[model samples]
Target chain A: MTTNSSDFGPTNPPASMNSVGPPAGVPDSAAFRSAGPPARMPDPAVVPPTGQSAGPGAESEPAVSLQGVTKRYGDKYAIRDMNLKLPRGRVVGVLGPNGSGKSTMFRMLMGLSRPDVGEVKVLGRNPGWEANGSIAYLPDRARWYADHTVMRAFTWAQSLLPGFNLDSALRLAKFMNIDLDMRASAMSRGQEARLMLILCIARSVPLFLLDEPFSGIDVMSRERIIEGLIEHMSESERTVLISTHEIQEAESLFDTVVFLQDGGVVLAGDADELRAEYGSMYATMQKLYRG
Target chain B: MTTNDWQVEPARPPGMFWALIRHDIKLRRRRGVVLPRRWRMAYAIAAFVILMVSVTLEGPKAHFYLNAVWYFTFGYPFMTLGISAGRIKREWRNGTSGWWMSLSMPRWQLVLAKAISSFIRALMIYAGTYLAVSILGAYTLVLRGTFNAQTMGQFLLQGLEWNGLLVGAAPFMIAFGVLLAILSSSSARPLAPLMWVVIGGLWWGIFPIAGASNWFAVHGSGQSAAITITPAVFPAIFGSWVLASICLFLSIYLMRRFVDISQA
Candidate 1:
């Protein structure tokens, strides 16, 4: 099943590809130096911004742009006439309560959902097949193939996703303490979460849309996942839009944060600015969500 | 990829469509459409026991009973329909459906591969059923000193001619099943199976109008009557092919326009 000449077995991959890995025997993930994004990480396919970014240095083309986008499922609307722009090369956190259309918005950005009105542009073109290559998506409530062990999952991704970095994936798996031979069905929830994150971050793609990566995991696993994210962030500059309810710990990861409520943005700005104005991101979100 | 891995030419790697087909086949080899593996296994064992008991007691009459396996082909189209919808539904239900939309191939190719995998699995089951029954029946007839190759061959050929209509209808059934899975809302999903029957019934309605009764009058009068077919089969199969094409087109359209296949 090995796709490449690399030592990783079970999945076949193209040639050699490396991910950002910390030095061996690092006790604390927080201390792991992010040597800056892996050189192979491609520039996010961001379209020239027609809308303005509210963040600093907004003049550079934004990675994602949505204009009056409305998506309805039957009688109810998922995202209603929403407009926003996300800057490239920053970690953006999408925070919202349950049913705030966070998942729907991600689906639209991935070209998995159609908008009833308005437009969505990712990396300069509409999402779907055209934008698929440049984006790595981790859908909400998604699990790995139940039949697949970590080794098989590596092979599955390598065979299907051309840019899949098997070497980094293997290293990440080791760092996460994930057993390569364990089937997804047999793994704990935390193990599965770590495995899924490795798959997304190991890719050489620019934009990452992660929905609920931390949902229903233990505190320890959450820290490990955060560590994985930090590793990815330090390795290279990439546009990552992560939506999660585990806001307290992940709040610090965001350079920019968008608060979604009832399918539209209630508040959005630079994370540091929002913190200065309202104290912690958790407090700001609680105020916005309750109010 | 090196050429030495496959039985085909090693120079060129498998194209996306072929690669997808290979992956899809591997996916379905273990996962059943409707039932769990235990139930399916129990079913096969039960069928084997019934066949063995019937052959032991009834001798050549078991061949007469096994002739009913031809009627099982009529069940193939519906089985194909279920497998087709199940394939798409599993991806959505599991949250591993990113590959479905993210692949840089044409939407039509995805639809075609979905149908092909389901069709292959259902056909394998369908053909396997007939193969088992026919082989056992043949052996029984030989043991009874009544194995008439020409006579049995003619009967089998006649059954093929009649059952061939279901084979023609299979494509339409498979395509419609896929469309129904995507077109229907989650709340409306419970009704999908009944919808298939109604749609399938409407397709079957054409046979009666095309003079199925007349063929029955001429060739289906008795057990020993000559099973001649009316010339309506070509038009029937042709009409189904046309409808199947239309279904595939509609499926492609839905993917490009309104349906977010994962949610759908």
Candidate 2:
């Protein structure tokens, strides 16, 4: 449980995939992986069986919702029958190993990619050009505009996007100790990540999707990014769906956690409840991967 | 879950058409040739001197020398097809296509920005190259004691007609290039080159119907090739604009539903 590597390093191997339903503690929703063909079994405890998920002081609308969504590329399924409803004004950590369809889910939510089947709604509407105003989406594997200075990039963003605040962005950059005159192509990966986070954080939007903001970042930059994120999230009524493999570092920020494997939800619940049930978010991850 | 599944992106530029123009300007030096700033200036100067000297010659020799410059002025848009395609492809090449797509603008607006920017870039290159060439050619004619004010005056009108034709054809060239770029990055890539020829081949059809060589010259061919501007120039330009609009419409339509930035 103490080890933080992506690998679980199982102590007790669970039953084989063919002989078992989900390994001892995993929810029935994980049956998609065990049954060969996907079967959606939204656990009543984690997934809202119908309508929007309601959190403490939650409004009528969920920040984002996906209903029986399945996206395929050629012959392979990137996401298969995924049903997710994230509550408004909550920090939901999307935890999964590589190839767990995490980025695919974010892309679908941002309307960059449409599902082959089912529906996805972001900020109470179908994700599209019109729905873009209420959501600040940070894509996985994004690079800064190679030719722009941080100031120019900010100016471009402020002009084009409806909710971006130029003062906040400049202040955020200063707070992160970055030089605005630096060209985007010359930025260190950590500085670029922090700058990107600032862009998302400064947007006056209700929903924020941050996909893998910590990979390859240095310790100091990660700490600053987390602090900046915490500062912004605490001050606003923002709903954020963040996907990260750095579970231990990001675990404290999650109000709820969803663990995915092979494009299906294997374990999900309130972060504190999961901590009490399985020891910690890390421990729950271990159990989910015990198979 | 894999590397492909994670999108911890840097900030995307805004989706406004002007935003792309600003970005393109920043990268202008880096496009095409990889020369240092001083070397690029030197090359332009050298080309200018050569064109000036060439214009001073008499007979077929002057025509032979100036033909390259004329072709560059008129043929300039053809060279930009790859450039226009490359401009769109650069987003994918830099792996920022998804970020560009996520910006809150319509897909057509994105493609339109590129088309317009490419057109502007083509015009800038044409203006710079020919302006210097024409000025220097006139200067050389003066130095040779054969500078004719009347020929020089007629050249201005010829220049406008040339500009008009280019202005008309530019949309089709740039729009088709954008279409080629999107299609080249798509599942329909195998058919792109063939599609380019069939659709863009319509550009040549106008030349035959309107009479290609009569009214189009950038102060050329000593005397024989230096024809005055014709009334047909207006119809020719109008025809090119029609074809260009069709290409732009096709590009916007395809970009909305078919073009996948991630694949780029």
Candidate 2's error at B14, in angstroms? 12
Instruction: State each model's C-alpha RMSD to the native.
Output: 13.1, 7.3
The digit string of per-residue lDDT tens for model 1 on B152-241 reads 785566566645555667788888877776656334456668766778788688567767445333444333345455665667667778
Residues B154-262, model 2: lDDT tens digits: 5555565566566667777787788888888775678787986786667576567656545443334555245445665766667667877887787777766666544
Instruction: Look at candidate 1 and tell me the lDDT of residue B35.
Output: 64
Worst 10-residue lDDT window, candidate 1 chain A: A37-46
lDDT of model 2, residue A122: 80
Native contacts, share recovered per candidate: 0.31, 0.34
> What's the count of clashing pairs in each model shown?
14, 10
Candidate 1 per-residue C-alpha lDDT over A237-282 given as tens digits, one digit per residue, 9 for 90 to 100:
6678999977998998887777776777655666776677567889
Clash pairs for candidate 2: A98-B1, A98-B2, A99-B1, A99-B2, A100-B1, A139-B7, A140-B6, A140-B7, A140-B8, A141-B7
